[model samples]
Target: MSEHLASIFGTEKDRVNCPFYFKIGASRPDIITPGLDSLGNPIPPKQLQQHFGDLYEDLFEELSKYGEIESLNICDNLADHMVGNVYVQFSEEEHASNAFKNLTGRFYAGRPIIVDFSPVKDFREATCRQYEENICNRGRYCNFMHLKKIGRDLRRHLFGRYRRSYRSRSRSRSRSPYRHKS
Candidate 1:
């Protein structure tokens, strides 16, 4: 590490810290969770652009109607489309709180938005595989045989549970203190 960056990060650099380690709070509000990589590490801003699409703009546009915005982040990593988290820092905590109070459960781009006061949590993946399969069966993105073969391959790849969860093995990594047994 460069001396300048070292001075920025402080000396206890060997240990991994949560992305929020340098932030003010011991625990962040549900508004944001750190974006994660496939191995579940924090992702950079450039990578986060793909996941939430234009939702960030939509959010800021909505929230700015109420107050000046400071920062907005949609936390998704390089792996899947599921949102690992989101973070929005308002100019004032009161604005943040007000945004949370008014926006929670409000619909945005059709789906109801969830406003969280603590660090962001993972949003469940859509079982759109079923829909994808149906579409493939109709020969949209793929054919039935191809989908079946992929399913079979996945099953064989992940201990013979064809239609379970891609996350099954990944979730079993037993590293995070936050990992929950399903």
Candidate 2:
């Protein structure tokens, strides 16, 4: 298999460091179901448990073959929780990177692994760049524009509060109008 070949000819650069892990965003393992209905909706939960169990098993197996398995997480955004994304941490960084490099752009089930180094600041920025490039131009306009508007509104709101606080402090300082009586 590809894995065996990679192991035989793989370099040290293909693996993890002491603190190895990568973050996978915008994926939901919990919502995944066994099959698609006539309307393309996901099948029932019990059916998913029966069928998708093997899929989960295979995923873990693939991960274990790469290096010492530490943790594999899936983003869950049920209830009031704002579960942002999923992160898989290995014992080493190199292992994590290796897994990322190999798995990225590869498809599993119906989705592809979008591997990247963790701690990437501003995912919105990245999406904007990708949108500009017109790489994945399958959908209508993205929600980035809306989110940007929201961010601008938030900034304006914060700025208004900050200006109010600054003005209040300045007024209080001037009202004292008296130098220290030595």
Candidate 3:
């Protein structure tokens, strides 16, 4: 039976780490569990994407402490096998190594996250669709991750300065009795 199992499932040595990228398996807030449904079955892909969003700055900042991140892509494809996977690319191999060491067993959102090195060296090459071209017919079922371009002004958004100013403006407007209200 052991030999039969080995034939069906490859040996543990078949799992090897990639050098440049790190793959993170994390919990989705919308899902009751990591990959399984309430009935212990696998969750569907569309439901996974509905709960997935861009990696917030808090996670980005935490990961940055280990090394400079080149790009972070969270897969939202409607494929059962590829949903909720986060790929983080580091600028240096040493940085990737450091992050892998530190984040392997860390918990996020009440679930332990699984981190492993990925074989993907270039995200652009892995993407099935081009942003500007807008020609990907695969839509939700595409195997590749479709990441939105983060603008250059990320620093501004990260610092809360934008929110502070917006709040001040709103407060001043509320103080004015003459302000038009719909």
Measured with C-alpha atoms, the lDDT of residue 47 in candidate 2 is 70
Model 2 scores a TM of 0.39
Q: Considering TM-score, which of the candidate structures 2 and 3 is the better prediction for this target?
A: 3
lDDT of 2 at 58: 63
Q: Write the per-residue lDDT of candidate 2 for residues 53-167, one digit (tens) a residue.
A: 4444465568756665454443222311112233455667788878887888887657666565655233444233444455534322332211111134533543355467669
lDDT, candidate 2, residue 105? 84
Candidate with best TM-score = 3
Clashes of each: 9, 11, 0
lDDT of each: 0.45, 0.46, 0.61
Query: Model 3: residues >4 Å from true position, as ranges?
Result: 1-54, 130-132, 155-182
Per-candidate TM-score against the hidden true structure: 0.35, 0.39, 0.56
State which candidate has the highest lDDT: 3
lDDT per residue for candidate 3 within 98-140, as digits (tens), equals 9999998899877787787776666776665553367778875
